[model samples]
Target: MAAVRVEVSVLPDSVLLQILALLPPWDRLRAAGVCRRWRRLALDRAVWKHVDLSQRRLSSGSLWQLLRRVLPAGLSTLRARGCLLSASRQRLLSPALLSALGKRCPQLRCLALSETDLRRIPYASVPASLTALELRRCELPISWFHPMAPSGTLRRLLLHHVPAFADWHLMAASCQHPLRVLSLRGTHRVTEAGLLQAAPQLKGLRHLELWGCGAGDATMGAIGSHMKQLRVLEVVDCPVSSAGLGPLKSLQGLERLCLELGEKVAPKAVIALAQALPRLRELQIVGACSGMDEIRLSLSHCSCSHSPQAPD
Candidate 1:
């Protein structure tokens, strides 16, 4: 009764559109079916600027319908995963669909695909407007990691659990951009040499993460020498110690540092880092709990993760 009494037409188009933009792709479709006024406002191009359909699967015909009905031409970022994109396959999205998306969404700036089959993606299929890309657990060709990368536009690249990813792959990738962030998690094959080779290319990188991947002092040294503007550094479940990490002192802007030691790091190395990164806001250290009490007590402000887990 209340919904009927309140005429939605009286609500400014801007307010209704804002409400529509906040809904997920599935819920947004449901809201559009509510009434004619909402359908008009929901169809506004700006509402479809960023569409993430990572949780649902759709048939090729269904995809075409969704694209025409809800996806606007002005889409800037599109994230799709677990989708039945091909008409023949129940769980695979065809490269043809990917190509169509790139063509239709000219303004697309960011693309993230996880748990998707990217077996046949072609060269130049990604829109040139893209600046950020994240791929995880996908069946992608090695060429997509290098030759197909949007060399001129990409500024941030993240690869997580990509079986094809390796140290040499990063070595071959286009490194023209001073990338802002390079996160390679679950890419165990990448090592010190691979990161070192790519470090020089990503001099402007601010956030660096090597989670659950092997890393050593050389990797730390490479990062320190190249990424001088690095702000956040997290190296979890990697074989890294305080020895080579001393180079981090060169980073004047470093704010947060989290290290999960895989080897016994020297105490002096920890002290060096504390003395070097004076502007640090949070410093978390795990696995080297033996002689860290004095160091932890000295830098009371910095949080250290100790055995049995220390208080926050």
Candidate 2:
């Protein structure tokens, strides 16, 4: 049989870019090195709109190269989890590098960093245009939330497993930023009093999640009283019971409610909550008492998920 040849270069740029987009970030970088034309197509703003470096051990030099050469200003979302931002005394994400990133990627909105040590990085160094910021297991400085610029665009903030996150940090963040959605998980230092104090400041919040916190019924009451605009509420392993959950009925706009309660929570309270929140489209109750069966039976018509284990 005669040898056949397929010229991939003949493919349309749009098609080629789509193919490149399907490749992993590292693979895409390698493909870009194939030829100048491939590199050009690979660097398309559309292809790099959302870059996920969660699996890569990105160093400072590589990060600088990415900002200066690879990433376009049109980049919107960047997820760099467990990135080695420093080695020895040198920091990977230096102030100058972060400044360069802000100047280079003006449109960047969502920045997610997990398990990355950001103790040295100031909050002011973050891109001012960002709308969403997520940090998990990051060693943040004591004054991380302090001296932050008044950001009208920054809305969603998620912090998980940040042991250093205290009541003062919450108070500072709520007072400074006009957050629409806030999620705090494994921040044990945040007490019920702190939440109550911060609740009034977060009146504009639409989505709120509290997990592994010291939130009690009082905190829930404060949220119900102040954050009437809330649409989604997730309380997992908090010290809240049915009494605290009672005030949640005031949230007429609530569409989704997730409760991963401890053994202390009653099943009847869950039922009462389901009944009160008629607007609730999705209700998930985990670790509720034996009454969960009865609650489920009562609210059979409603869309809900009742399980002993909470979904990860």
Candidate 3:
């Protein structure tokens, strides 16, 4: 038999770090358990920066062990986005992993833990350097946002499907930082007055999403007045009328706009929307808004092909 020779290029530490950083959470963890050279390469500070512990797959003990090995005290950033938990296994995170994460990944930025049980997942005194936080699904206790400590550098923030803020005043008051991107999706409890009061303070805010938000036109108007530099705005399932977005014409940076016009919006209303936000690069409309004949027909056929409504 001929000698079966395989030639492979050995990647340097820098290249290896880039490769490891791109791998999924579990794969990275496994790679860290390889030989000493690979282990050292895997444990680099940059390797575990964007940790995705979503789906709550790894046991608390295993997570702790992995963190101890790969994520040293020197780690600066940790992004655990899309973290999930079944109804039966809500409070599954152990204290050790939480402690290590809070202490080690102090400069944590872009933390996206959507649809996870965060009630018992010890909320660390968030580091000042932390910028973006997407708490999309976790219905944390009111105490979570009670700390009034201002994070001057914090930028993007997204809150979706969380419990109503019992003390909305305190919650809004606590957000002294200037935000760039903000999303308040499915926050039924947040009244228009509360949001209007807080919107102006976030002077740097450019992108805003109020999906299923119960705020009225007055609040929407208030937001528009304050957010002069606003770019992209999504008012999904909200009742903001043509008048609400009328002021958006002044927004020179406006790019994308999404609105659910509901069952009875006339044809003229839809045309008005396109005219109002003329610079819109992308527009998504749901329900019975008229004047979008081509869009409606296309959507109707698309919806019928699958399950009618867009798949979850």
Candidate 4:
């Protein structure tokens, strides 16, 4: 009898990571501990290109251990895809881990910590490479923005339901970079003065979203006049009207405008917007504002759609 020899080809690190990315969290963690080579490969940033830690059922100690073990040596990008951290569970994320991440991931650029507590963020320390940041439903203090971030690299910023902006002056001063995109939805404390102070710094801005804020016509006009590069302006759930929209007519570069019509904008408001801002490509009117009388607009490159009813 003769013994037969067999051999199997080994997959490359990149290919192995691609395979590991498809596995569940626990399974991936288990695979990382298989061997030294496997552990190193699994911890590579490529394996976490699109991390989704939603409903992972991870304990505080276990989460810290996993982050310490699995996170790559020098990660350049991180996406906390829509993870919810309850008050009690927030303790699981240690300040040490956050600080370590800030110091280690100096090349990190994009961060999406949606629906997580901002108290978890060591605001005093942050990666200099951060450019795009999304903080949704995060409870951060006003002092969080006092620490000057790496300004030259920052571009996009989104803050939703953040009450910490009562002293919005600090935010304006800290955000000195020319932002391309800015969104502050449901930031009740956001005032017109704060926006006015910040608009000049964001001269290169193209998209601005200010929903459910107190900013009226004056604020919009200020931004429209300065941001010559502004393209898309969305001011839904605000008190601004078509008269306030009048200033945007000169914004030859403007493309999209989403406004919520109310007391400030009468039935004749749409007529003025259509007459002016000929470059506007898209217009959306929701809530009570959409009930305005339909005005026939003849524009070749523009489209208009309005909801007769408010969002349910």
Best-performing candidate as measured by TM-score: 2
Backbone-clash count (model 1):
0
Q: In candidate 3, which residue ranges exceed 4 Å CA deviation?
A: 1-14, 58-63, 72-77, 81-102, 115-124, 166-174, 276-278, 294-312
Clashing pairs in 3: 81-112
Candidate 1 per-residue lDDT, tens place, 195-297, comes to 8778887787889888766577888888888888889988876756657677778987888887765466766677667767777878777555566676676
Model 1 root-mean-square deviation:
4.0
* Model 4, C-alpha of 17: deviation from truth (Å): 4.9
Candidate 3 per-residue C-alpha lDDT over 244-302 given as tens digits, one digit per residue, 9 for 90 to 100: 65665656567776666545556565555455555656666655544566444433212
Best by lDDT: 2
Stronger candidate by lDDT (1 vs 3): 1
Per-residue lDDT of 1-312 in model 4, one digit per residue for the tens?
899664312767767878887776667778778898777766667776555554444445655665676666556556553335555555434466566766756667777665555565556555557788777676674556553654455688887776665536325433745578888788888777777776667777889888877778887788768877888987877756666877777677778877776665765666666567767778777666534435434444567777654333
Among residues 3 or more apart in sequence or in different chains, the pairs in candidate 1 whose N, CA or C atoms overlap within 3 Å are none
Q: What C-alpha lDDT values do all the predictions have?
A: 0.73, 0.82, 0.61, 0.66
Which of candidates 1 and 3 is the stronger one according to TM-score?
1
Candidate 1 TM-score to native? 0.85
Candidate 2 — which pairs collide?
85-92
RMSD of each: 4.0, 3.1, 5.5, 6.0
* TM-score for each of the candidates: 0.85, 0.91, 0.76, 0.77
Which ranges of candidate 1 are over 4 A from the true structure? Answer: 1-11, 59-61, 83-88, 147-150, 174-177, 266-268, 288-293, 300-312
Per-residue lDDT over 175-275 for candidate 2, one digit per residue giving the tens place of the 0 to 100 score:
88889999999998999888988888999999999988888888888988999999999988874676887898899889998887656777787778778
lDDT of 4 at 53: 59
- Give one clash count per candidate, in the order shown: 0, 1, 1, 1
The per-residue C-alpha lDDT of model 1 at residue 57 equals 58
